[model samples]
Target: MLFLDDSKAAHLFFNRLMESLPDHVYFKDREGRFLCVNRAHALYLGLRSPSEAVGRTDYDFFEPAQAKQKDADEREILRSGVGFIEKEERANSIKGVERWVMTTKLPLFGDDGEMIGTFGISRNISEMKQAREALNAHHRLLSTLIDILPCRIVVKDREGRIKLTNRTYRTALGLAEEDSVLGRKLSELSSDGRTQRYAEDDRAVLEQGASILNREDYDASPLGDKRWLLLSKVPLRDASGRVEGVVGMAADITAQKESEARAVEAQRALEEKNRQIESELQIARELQTELMASSMQSVQAELAAGSPFLPRLAFHYEPSAHLAGDFFQFVPVSQKSFALVMCDVMGHGVKAALVTTLVRGLVANIRVDDTSPAQTLHALNERLCALLDRPPLPRFVTAVHALFDTEAGVVRMASAGHPWPLLEREGEGAAPVSELECGPALGLIRGAVYRDIEFSVARGDRLLVFTDGWTEEADDDGEEFGIQRLAEALRRCRAENPYTTLDDLATALRGHAPGRTLADDVCAVLAAF
Candidate 1:
């Protein structure tokens, strides 16, 4: 009905079909001039009507380069009698707008089968092209991101076929750039035992849909070099939450494993060394106890036998560690007098115990005629200063020396950076004897002079000498049991026996300490006059 037998009706139908199409339809003569054009083609050339572009060519409407390419292509189609089908090309319009179009060009034939001109149709494909280009760019960016990472990464399908891999993964398998690994199974790439094991693991993950995290394994490189690796594999799921693949990551942990092994060995050796030192310290502790007890007991016995007035000396020694830094020695200097020396070296343990040993040796060389407390400390300081002169940091000792003359009823005491003694008279309260002057700690300055303070003591009076540990014990609140508290505790003791009095004072100190345990070495001596 559209092409009823009349030539006018056929012409009208052809024009309507051409104008209704969204694509540009055009025809050109042998000379490359537009013979006819549809409405869409006319509008693309910036023409008001189809007739307006009848005598024009692409050169009048497009850039020189595009026009030239179009002319060359149409001429080739005309000569070869072959059509260019669905070829994508860039089109630049007169309005300076660029578009990508898929075009089909055909050589037109007349009724006599002779080539007359070229006819073409072009469809816009700019949006589709742009979308495809953006997708390719994203793929490149993702590939670069994974390739730059140091960890080996791999992605595989549920069938155990490799879908993606990073550069490190390829290099670890000694794969060259030209090698194609995608879509290949692990066994196909390498038939080694480890590769087979990896295939099994992939199957297990796919079946169970579980994640295997940080599994340490011993492995070998392509070159047979041993290595340690921490590997993790997790099931990659789809939008519907079904496991479809696996993402695997592996990190080289050989260095860390080796370091841990070395640390374990070092710890074992250190524990053994500690046990050996502990055994030696036990022996030294026994020897120290025997030597100190024998020296003190002999002096006490000698004084009791020689002097008309018998004096009582009682002491309590408690070492916080296996060995103590606190030491005391009693020397009988005359028929009616004795010298008592007490010392506390800086810290407790082997070093302090060694210093105490050296002090004991120096005390043994003291002459029996020298009863001056200050002179004895001066002599000890000079020897210690010479002996401990070389050190990164110097060691020090606090000391108190006293000469007790029972017949004269006097105690002459001198201190070298030690705590002041506490004095308690019969029927009077106890207090620190702070009036006694103090000198620098021993092992500091050579020839450091010490001065003695003479205090009278009658019958039924008592004097107490102690280390800082007794006054520096702290409770849970970090408050120290200071010298005042110590004096208060001493005043509360009403026992007549000197030993009982010392025990009561120690109990008070233990009660004030955290966990009822002392944190430092403590030494205390009570002299009952």
Candidate 2:
């Protein structure tokens, strides 16, 4: 071999280095025609050697658009006389897929210092380009999902500074674009007294590297509107599984809170009403028991007196509820004459009790000196009708009045649409004594007339005065304890002692239907002469 000069040897070494590079190297003339190509460029072009790629333009293998772009790049490099780098560009290859390449081109000059050609080096960067594109698409999808979510979402860095917030969070806080809430600490953005507490809680979550789910009441808006929010915060971790930051979400629950409060208030009101009703019922029951005891005591005391001609009296009183509208009284009109009254209002409970009390007061205060039974009833109806005409008028009541003169041995009775009185003799069957068809009920029609019927009372004759409550009481199966039943019950007990007979009658009526409650007030008075 002949010895070569240093310059020639260096030129040979540079050509070998270019061919060995893991890239395509080429030189193009000013008109963009290839002048020379390295071994790598020739291999990439599907040529066995550089001689096949030399002396060809890019138009020989590239599409028109690709050729034009390459020519423009070469012209730019030639005109600039400086190296130019392109991070990524597309290159057509003999294979099915296009290749992504990073290219650097420098201007080449002749010995005259005039630009001659462009020297280019290209490296394949397809994988890196695909990865960067995928990353960008993922970021765009994540941002869209956060913006459209219903709940407020926020992201904070490890330092407790806000990094990102969703659309819902910004809208709820009424923040403007000029307000840079990002990179700000929660305590700095929240001006309320509770902000410091929230910051402390966030610190705890970070230190513990755990999640926090809590229900909190906050007044965050400038208008100070209270709202309930369910907050959930989770720690975010880095690739090393170390806690990096926290992501939080808050959902508003103001409407649900208000509804629960209303429900609680309604329950309290219902409980209070029930308590009032129960208390009233208790008081009414006690009053009714006391009234019955007083009436019995008066009858017993009158019996103890030395009045041989006095009529023996007995009573049975029961109520459907704690209070009743049925009442009965015996007044000693004189030593020889006595008056008896029974009254029943239209309804029961507090309303009926009020009318029954009014009737009781009227009968106690009214003077009926030698007055006939019909006249006394007429007077009572007029008084009751007048009372009903005032504000808060009463409904109506059925009443019966009777007067007996032991000296004359005569009994007179009248009714205001009340059930007729029953009369029983020692050897005769019980019969209704007063007329069945009578005047309207008391307080129904003012100045209404009443009819009186009189009969002689023989020795050992019994007169029974009662309100319709006794006949109207219902059994478990809804059958009434009717007038016929009461008459039969009396006939069975007629021969018994008057006091014992009354007690037995009351017990029999209550026991008529076992396990069944009484459904009305009952009052029965028995007078024996």
Candidate 3:
């Protein structure tokens, strides 16, 4: 360093240095009166020259309160031989403009080593203070934003130490106080060691720089309540694209998993119940078949021993479902006279099968020899109406009852909303007995009547009485095998044996049906006189 040799030159250098400085610099006596001030300090006090502020105190320019506080601070510094270094305080210009200043004050000493006064410097820091406050406010807002999210969020460093966690994650950890888990590893927070598994995942993200998304895991709460969690972890990287840590999020899906489990259990239970119902239906179908077959055998034995004019009686019965709605009854009016009742109840399956059972019981009670064919149908209708009248939907049956008097050589027939039978004469081809007056179906009216039509039958003549399932058989074009078609089919199957004729007729009707399948229950009775 070079030294100034002349005193005047040293004095000039000092004054120039003070004038060029932007900060306020001043020297105050022990009584807190200004002895000399730099140009910036004089200008701040509203003085045109530094000489004007030589003997003035802070009270001359500043408010009394501010000046008093400054005097007290300087006195303390002087008495303790200490100094204030970059202490922040409020400063007001002579024009009453408020500013923030960073100040340093020291106790000054003379060349003789005795305490002389205090010299201090101050710099404005108002803009820097405002910027710092704004940054702090933004940080608080961001913290509050993440805290309100429902998803549990956590951030960990490469060392597996927790760096940040939101409110939801803290609650999962059983932490009531905020940010207490920071700087601690997850394994340290719990003794169950389940957190160690989570640490393994975090390590993968930090080491391999790969993300794990939507990983479902079973978790237990601190109180040991079982739950399922869906976790997602992403590697947090630095500016250089190197993995630095991990950011993990989790969602509690316990309710959804439990609901799915319950649904699966319910579905399994329903399937088992359906199987039980199917087994019961199969049993019912077998029982119905046995009952019908037993009745047919008994009637055939009676006819084989008692009557010779009525040579052959054959029937073809089929149902579209496991259970049938069509059934027939043969009541022996006498050794030489018998009546055939063929019925088709509305619908198929279990409900219609039940109705057929009711009809069979009703027919068993009627006296076929005493009542005419029309009178028998009237009785059946009244009984059905009385039994099945009150319902959301109406149940009904279409029936055709025919009395064959082999001794008298005549057949009496009546219809109740049923198709009239086809009469195949010995010489003439087959034709529907359309002369019968058809009445309403049974169970529809309380006192409906039907008129009987009588016609003579010679030996080798055949009578075919069938339900609508035969006449209503449809082809692919929706054309029904109507009464005329059924008459034609019967004529085409005119064999000497009634059983052979019925089998051939059934084959012809099935050929007309689509896919050789019947869409409804079928019942037909053929008698050769």
Candidate 4:
């Protein structure tokens, strides 16, 4: 028999050593009964002491099938008389939570050289298994992100062979699944010089260990169309600081480039139109200056000798545009009788200016025997209708014709779609004069009836004739300089001379309007008796 004393001491020492181990340790007999258990094993099994587990079979603490498997493993270890290792195995805790473990079983022998039991140790591998699962999940997520990205992505190895490409990259190149482009270089796919250049650029970035971004004006598409793209290339490096590959992303900018092109064309067209309008306005200004000079000369020559009965007429005329369509005329019918007429054509600029010139010529040649205001208007209407008979001709003029008989102090007036004239008596307030509106706008209808209306004019009385331009002008705020404002402005300046009164009225009208540019031409004639 073996010496029981030293054997018992050796067993106690081995058990004490196993009790200090970090992992769980136990010994099972060939019958699968727990012969001994260490502190770690008791703690793992939720036993108060090793004595509670001694002499108990694995089936006493574990399920029957699991206990049978353990019993078989222990018998195998004892029979083999060698150590065996299980890299990974499932274990159940006392609370029934499953865990992964790395386990080792060593056969134990008695002094007689016969296997008695198996010594087993187990290490928890649950954390390592979980880490591997997490890494696999992360890789799957990264692959999904690459496939779903809107931009084209590509990865190339140091040899310029394509290692990976995203969905957009394949779509952009019109690649087929059987093409096997993953290991092919860009030059193999596209032999064009432009593709070669892009590969060279990517290689340079990899060599320099630098990134390129937003390199514009680079051809990116394989198609012959002139398309643009924004390209970015980043060098991928290994742990040793060596360039391994390049990751590139390209975004198509064809639409943005087309928009820029269209904007340039629009800008050119707008500039050309502005130049044409400016040229037309300059020519119109020169013609208006010449017309004003000639009209003033004619007026001075006609009034060379002071007339006995003609009123002393001084006037002021201002145009908001290059050319004005407001016309004024004074014709002497007799030694003591004169007719004063004012007309405003429909609009401003060259067209309206030409219409005013026609009115001037008609009034200058009108016969003095025409004593009726209605008759003069009838003759003027026929002349305008004949002149404006062509296609796209302007066909409207608002007019007031007055026959002033100085000897009788009578003013016979007639209007055709014109603003009413203001009359200011010497000691009375200003009011609109009564006149007959007997006709439509001139050139609108031929043979329209016009009637003359008579009003008496005495000394220190005034008759003011004006165009709708004065009362219908718009400000920046879109409000009109209405008739009420015009009347108020005229009444305020009634005491001034004909020229001074009209000047003050025009100035006030301009000041009241917020915008610097006038919306229409303004014209006014002040006749003081």
Which wins on TM-score, candidate 2 or candidate 3?
A: 3
In candidate 2 the C-alpha lDDT for residue 275 amounts to 93
TM-score of 3: 0.64
lDDT agreement of model 1 with the native: 0.84
lDDT by residue for model 3 (221-248), tens: 5334588888899999989998889999
On TM-score, the candidate that comes out on top is: 1
The digit string of per-residue lDDT tens for model 4 on 232-254 reads: 89998889988999998888887
Candidate numbers sorted by TM-score from highest down: 1, 3, 4, 2
- C-alpha lDDT score of every prediction, in listed order: 0.84, 0.77, 0.83, 0.75
Return whichever of 1 and 2 wins on TM-score. 1
Off by over 4 Å in 2: 1-309, 458-461, 494-500, 511-516
Alpha-carbon RMSD to native, per candidate: 4.1, 10.8, 8.6, 8.8
- Ten-residue segment with the worst summed lDDT in candidate 3? 1-10
Off by over 4 Å in 3: 1-169, 182-184, 203-216, 219-223, 229-269, 304-308, 392-394, 426-429, 435-437, 458-461, 473-518
1 or 3, greater by lDDT = 1
Best candidate, lDDT:
1
